[model samples]
Target: MFTTRPGRPPSWRRALVTGGAGFLGSHLCTRLLDAGTEVDCLDDLTTGRPGNVEHLAARPGFRFLHLDITDPCAPDAVTGPYDLVLHLAGPGAPADCRRRPLKSLDAAGLGTRTALGLADRDGARFLLVSSAEACDGRGDDGPPRSPWDDGHGDTADAPDPIGPLHTYAEAARFAEALVTAHAGARASNAGIVRLYPSYGPRMRTDDGRTLSTLIHHALAGAPLTVPGDGSRPLSVCYADDTAEGILLVAASRSVRPVDIGADPEPTVAEVARAVLGLTGSHAPLEFTDAPERRSGGPFDGRPDGRGPDTGFARELYGWVPKVSWREGLARTVTAVSGCPGPAPATTAGHGTGRWLP
Candidate 1:
């Protein structure tokens, strides 16, 4: 657990979450509603599952809007004097990126622009939920490569000047730049949150993230396919902790981007073993989402070689992850399996850095 910075946490009367139906977005929506804030959850369901927000639809002060943030009409569709606008309207999963490549680019570009505009108009605080690609904060992997050369190694394309397509990392980079530019030009109360990896309920089984894939394989009694000798440091945070960190950043008036995540240190193989133990499945390990398998294709559940940085999050908001990966993973398993979680497990791998593994 972490300490709350000395001060009153920021509160909102109402909020607008662009990707409110998505995994993390849905969590944010639920948190805001629980705080007695009116929430207008909007999503076109491009990469988001409607069922994620279905439970919240009946809750008081919750409104689900089926609208694409990239659509020109999106502006008119959202009538509001919102105090907060969380711009999380983008394809979050690797599988979604592979299936909807252009949509990823559009969300980062047009989607971010639309959300920022709405926030500025309503005089609301805005937060652009971003991926780790916003910066080379993690030095383990080199920068993105040319789209054509991605098959060689370190998958991802450079931001093309005139190309219609872009990789998810490129899209995230562009989105952060846009948010920064928006704040500079209009002096809007906006910030960007660079998320590393998070796992919990509502995660799509086919999302291709390391933990999601491992859990899926364990539950199905299938092989736990891994990548790169399964030694990558894949740290992660629980959805509940991630949601609260995001809200903390949103409440603050800082515009600088902050990294939010927490967890015990663990290698890919260790993560897989934990999943298998929890499910009580003897699923064999299979190293498949490896470098050789990247082929410049969509992201395959690989953790970016870098660890989480909680410096800004701690200094600014006094935020740190509350749940260990084991605890969070157990909750996720119970949610997915519709049964009581297995008995309490031993402590997760020792040591902590960024919140996920």
Candidate 2:
């Protein structure tokens, strides 16, 4: 049974999550429930597994509708206009996007448009979850940055329309634009959060994201694999931390971009080492200069410290990440290692398999 945190208790009656059964989306649903919000989960079970939300199926106030944002059906046609719509249903991992670039593009572009249309028609607030990749290749724009980067981190001497390092990055940019345009027109408030590397429970084990790669290796007591020089620094945010930021934007009146990440940037190598430490694994880490894993270039991995530094997050809404990296990782380790059980048989349309922790 999900319980509430200590407080007067926020009572947001109607909330909608686009990718409710995905890694981050599930957590968002949990957080919303804790805040006393009735959540409607919309997912088509494409990348999202039904098991991710099976636990919440019994919640009196929770409703799960199988609908893909990229291609919405009648059920997902907004049964009741939501008070707030948190759209987190795009391709987040690079590999996932690469595997199905078209679907990813559709989700980021058309999916965003659909969500915005729903919000506009319902007169609901919208909060789109963007990525730090939207900032620049370096992960963030930087504390002292150039205003001309267009948040996608302009490559040195690169052309004016900086080509995206990956299709997913481009899709996020498009989605943000879609949301922003809709917000300016209809919604009372809207904002986009450019999240850096976020790690926590519910992430799929097989996903090609860095944290998942490390955790899987550690779990198997195998050598952790490092791609390229392992010099790329990522502004990793804990899942709960990112969720808190998302919640803040959802409840806030301000409509702008917010960079959600942690300080003391950790290199990719450091991330692997941290996961090993958290897992109590003494396995050796094998660093390989895999060309496929190499960062596109200096511009691809640049980190920009923009967003929340402007005090937009705090000034508009009382939002702060309560969990530190170490604490967040510890919790993640526990959740990933200790689980409900093994997942059941999964098929494309069967919807029986649970999502990875």
Candidate 3:
């Protein structure tokens, strides 16, 4: 169970996690429960599998509700006076977003609105789990120092119009705007967290994110596909660290968007090689042609000095990612390779199969 550190006091008692059956969401649920908080997990299972949370079903203070936050009756279905509400519902996988653009948009737009409304009604502190994509298109340079950092004295560039490649990014940007507006109205105490590429256990093999795809390819002894030049840098946080960063923000009084990710950012090719090394797979690296628009360029990946500054989080909540990428990737490889086949239909007194639409 989570215990109070020397300076931090217990902040959450009851919590609700939207998208709580998915990879990062499931980790968040586990962490909250470990902190001795009663948790109600809401998920539609569109991309989240029940097996992810089957272990938690028997936990005394944990309950999982199979429902989409965007549904009209969702708020009524899960009545709550939760002390904290974490909005993590949304399609973040590139392929999933490309195939179900509307669903992705609705999840960020309508889903966030619904979550915000629920938090407002319950007077709960709200946390919006946004993405690094939200800061996309701001400029070719890099993300601003902080979400609150509007370039000092420098004229801000005109905002780019949403386009095909930016569907998910645009949706997240919209969600941030909505959250900002809601906070301005004092609807509820709320904060926005922009997550970089996060990877760990329970990541879907077909999710279309690079790290998971690389690991899956290594496991199957298939070619690891690296789109374009493979120079796009990514700073990935383990699921546990990402969840902890979110909780730090939730427990704090700050509402500004703090970036949650680790540094020494590795290139796509570097990550592929790491996976191969870890799994001892001889999978060949295949560089595929990608649309020019989709070919992301290199990024500044320094931990504390350059790129998006995480100092705000450190000073405010004393948060910094503990797990190194090498270690985290190894753990992920073990978990994925050892994952059991489709779990039994029933386990821990709750359904483990896919929830119906």
Candidate 4:
């Protein structure tokens, strides 16, 4: 297991999260605050919405700053002499990554460099929230799926071409390399936590992410369209679980790559059904032929569905997910359905970042 740095949470024990106002980032902010650590949330509001963090707006220890990670002034704008920097400002979905390839690439690579530079300058620990996309896309193709088995043998009828499409994976790989190089150059303590598909409240219904899209479609009583056979196996993590894992690694000195996700991959159809059940929308099901398959879609870009090994689990900060997929889905359904009104409004002047929604 990786050890915590000596004299950790140093003078500037505050945490600066580059995308602190987004779905996952907001959750991370909550965790840090609950632990009594002051958190500075920086977001450009590109996808980070104010609603995701409305409850946290008034908290004394939480400060939100609207800015882009790619901006040179990001470090100055946040006023960070931070003890830790969690870089979660990259693209959120495959579609967006595909549609805005340049932005995605820049954010994943240059953005990472800037964040790590801030960490190095401030002498703070850095944790990069990476994607499982770096596993090389296109994992043995047979059929396209939502959650295909990562370790199935040939003739399994499941397809996972294990190569990333476009520059998304390349940028991720580049970012990882940058971190490793920077750490080695300065002997800095930096690491990466590669996350798989995760879903929960605060996810934008409008974004093209499958999880949110399915939930939105179900709630709207619209046809729940399965892109393919829906037999593709998928592993999803609850946002809270992902946040916990991130904290575990960020706080620990785990410098190696660690895979964090839920096991026993669920099929795309199952996810659709789950959403329908949760929302009580009884949405009709539909399947469309996905002819233009990306080189490396979700099914083939991640580690096998097998659980992490003991050594890896320990080295990744002894972190394990607490919430199950079913429980998480139920909780999210309730929360969204019970939303008092529209999500919280993005505020300014209090150091809160820009408002996207």
Best by TM-score: 3
Across 89-119, the per-residue lDDT of candidate 2 in tens digits comes to 8656666676677778888888888887776
Quality of model 1 by C-alpha lDDT: 0.73
lDDT of all predictions: 0.73, 0.66, 0.73, 0.68
For model 4, the superposed segments whose C-alpha errors exceed 4 Å read 1-12, 135-164, 288-311, 314-316, 337-357
RMSD (Å) per prediction: 9.8, 5.5, 5.2, 6.7
Global CA lDDT of candidate 3, please? 0.73
For candidate 1, the 10 contiguous residues with the lowest summed lDDT are 348-357
TM-score of 3: 0.83
Better of 2 and 3 by TM-score: 3
What would the per-residue lDDT of candidate 3 be over residues 111-204, giving only the tens digit for each residue? 9999999988888888988776445222236544433245674434323445555665567778888898989987469888877777788876
Error of 2 at 212 (Å): 2.1
Q: Could you estimate the TM-score for every candidate?
A: 0.82, 0.79, 0.83, 0.79
Pairs with backbone N, CA or C atoms under 3 Å apart (clashes), candidate 1: 226-286, 234-357, 235-356, 235-357, 236-355, 236-356, 236-357, 261-355, 262-355, 263-355
